[model samples]
Target: MARAGAVNYLFGTRFYKMAYVEFGNPAAPAVVCVHGLTRNGRDFDALAEALSDRFHVICPDLPGRGKSDWLQDGLAYQPPTYVVALAHLLAQLNKPVSWVGTSLGGICGMMIAAAQNTPIKKLVLNDIGPYIPSASLQRIRDYMLEAPERFGSMADLTQHLREVHAPFGLLSDAEWAHLARFSARQVLDPTGSGKRIAMHYDPKIIDPMRAAVPLDVDMWPVWEMIHAPRLVIRGAESDLLLCETYERMLKEGAEGYVVADAGHAPALMDYESQARIKAFLLEG
Candidate 1:
């Protein structure tokens, strides 16, 4: 059976929605898994399956992505907005929650978890941390700042993924097809040309003071505020999460691990990555 679910909630005067997948008993210890930029809750499917029996896992699609409703104003697609929405979601659950966030989601978790007396009991940052490299951020923005482009067929989409997400490494043709279908949603135009989802987020979400210049934001204060037990996973070849950041985490006494043959992020499907995360989350 499909383990997915969704709930609607309001932010400010605007109404929005988010989708989640639930697993295990409601009364059990809870874990929240969030997806990276341009991805949805569905990205956690494999990892959720592995943890479902042991914990109450809920993976939510963030606003402007996946099944979540797009804001009438795309400028609202910032980390602070997501943190507020998630605070409401956790209040709905009415329990202390732990978090495992990939990429953008991880950044949100860090901000929330660092707050004094925050509800997040433990944190697992998958392929993200404070002090994101400018080069990696620019690469992500380059893709997000563009309007959804159409492809002739699944093969065309796969080629796009290969060039853009080469860090994800080689997948079989079938795997590429599976990802392409989920990442795209049909547009309502008369001709029915398909469009990439998350089309609602404004391309200028992060406008530089001048065009073509990189934007930089420092997050060391937030990183230092983390109080709960934390685990950070970095893919060995990742452009986003660097070795230096991982080493600094180790120096700060946070648990750290690296995955092989992966870049930017490693899907929890990797055996070593799963074991490292599972062990951290299960620790008493």
Candidate 2:
């Protein structure tokens, strides 16, 4: 195992905290892994552990979704908010960083990298891009829009996770348990709220984004602006990243990988997915 630590830093007047977990020597070149919407830093645990030997890995729980503090307003959960937070994070790190971002995280990467100057030196966009389908966006909003309610036990939460994240596909009970544990934080009482607190994220974050979808905002100009090496990974069954979009990416000279048995996103947990990501990140 690589040496690791948790570092928290402020983002704005709001005092958002990002939990940074390192998996290798501090001196090693760094790769930062950002999780999807509704996910936290722990989502990268397995992947970071696997790469610890060769790279210093930093995984941050985006505000409102993990150990990080939730925004006072859910509307603050938008991409512009995240992009600013990321810029702050980069300034603190004080170095060029490689990025591995899934879904929402990937979009943040796209926006940042498309700019005239970006902190990222290389990027791995996992199951996301300029174009996202309305069906998938609607599916995600439907789940995110739900209000939190009491569940009798962890078992109930686990079942809910499985049902809502059915796109993640069948996993063992143990896997579901792991997902449940990291997803919800105690909200009940001092001894700990047996009642789960849905990590505070405003579902309204996706509203302005709705107009940008169906065919997706013309992020193509930004795609052309990125100078860093880039690799895009799409789940073969992903509804969000279309085959046509992937082809457009290829025409733009971007490299890509397709993962089987995944949808919307690839966790990079499976060996094949891991191999693809590792190779891309390690590329000269």
Candidate 3:
């Protein structure tokens, strides 16, 4: 297990630092795992640890999430800005990488993999696809907008996460604990009396989502442009990635895996999920 490290870079004159964790030998094949919207790289801890024996796994905290710096402009949270920031991170790695992404992270990977001369060698989209239904988008947006800003204690916050992320599947108590531990930070109470626990990510990240709630997200052209062999993981009960879209992805030459008893997204923390991802990434 490698300790966390920070990568410093500039995005249009704004200096920012992105935090990341690494695992396995530096010389080993690189695998970059990105988290979903409102999630940080720590979400991949279990998966990264499991793959450390054979692959160098890098999980990065995108801007406004985890230990990374928050963008001054909320609008900068879009995919284009993420691509630029991730490009810098990839440049620092200086190696071809397999990408494992969840939701927002998957969208980023799709865009990068579709680009000319991209460094991505293979792509794994976890419970996300090229097309996002309007209903799903609205559901996510509503949840973010209504999320609590403060919690009286870690236990309270943990309970909140359990409810909000129940769609992540049947996580064990330990798994839920891990999510709670890394998903929040202490912040001064609004009353200016003491401190309270708050969600780890910047709330401003929802700004762009509020500004534009598109009828649906269509990225099929981007998906069509990608040449890298890919795998799509979907939660059997996911409202976000419909069965129709998953089937279409398979028809378009992508391998597919479905996790039962999960919704919206499957947490790749379990042994079976980790094994499936490792096998796909190791393929020739």
Give me the candidate number with maximum lDDT: 3
Q: Could you tell which candidate, 1 or 2, scores higher by TM-score?
A: 1
User: Candidate 3 at 277: error in angstroms?
Assistant: 0.7
lDDT per residue as tens, model 2, 1-284: 53434445455565666655668765777888888887776777778877777788888777666666566665567778777767777777778788999998888888888776677989999888777767777777667657355555677777887777766644667767777787765566444556655443334445544445433445677777888888999888888888999888878877999887777777677667777778887889
| Model 1: ten consecutive residues of lowest lDDT | 195-204
Candidate 3 C-alpha lDDT tens digits along 1-284: 76788788788887899898998987999999999998889899999999999999999999999999999999889898888889889999999999999999999999999999999999999999999999998988998999988888888888998888899999999999999988999888769644498999999999999998658999999999999999999999998898999999999999999998889889988889999999998888
Collision pairs in model 3:
238-264
Per-candidate TM-scores read 0.88, 0.87, 0.97
What shift in Å separates residue 192 of candidate 1 from its native position after superposition? 7.5
Instruction: Report lDDT (Cα) of residue 198, candidate 3.
Output: 91
Instruction: Give the per-residue lDDT digits (tens) of candidate 1, residues 163-279.
Output: 676666545666566566667664455555554232323344444312555556578899999989999988889888778888888789789888777787776765567677889
Residue pairs in clash, model 2:
188-193, 189-193
Model 2 earns a TM-score of: 0.87
RMSD of each: 2.8, 3.3, 1.2
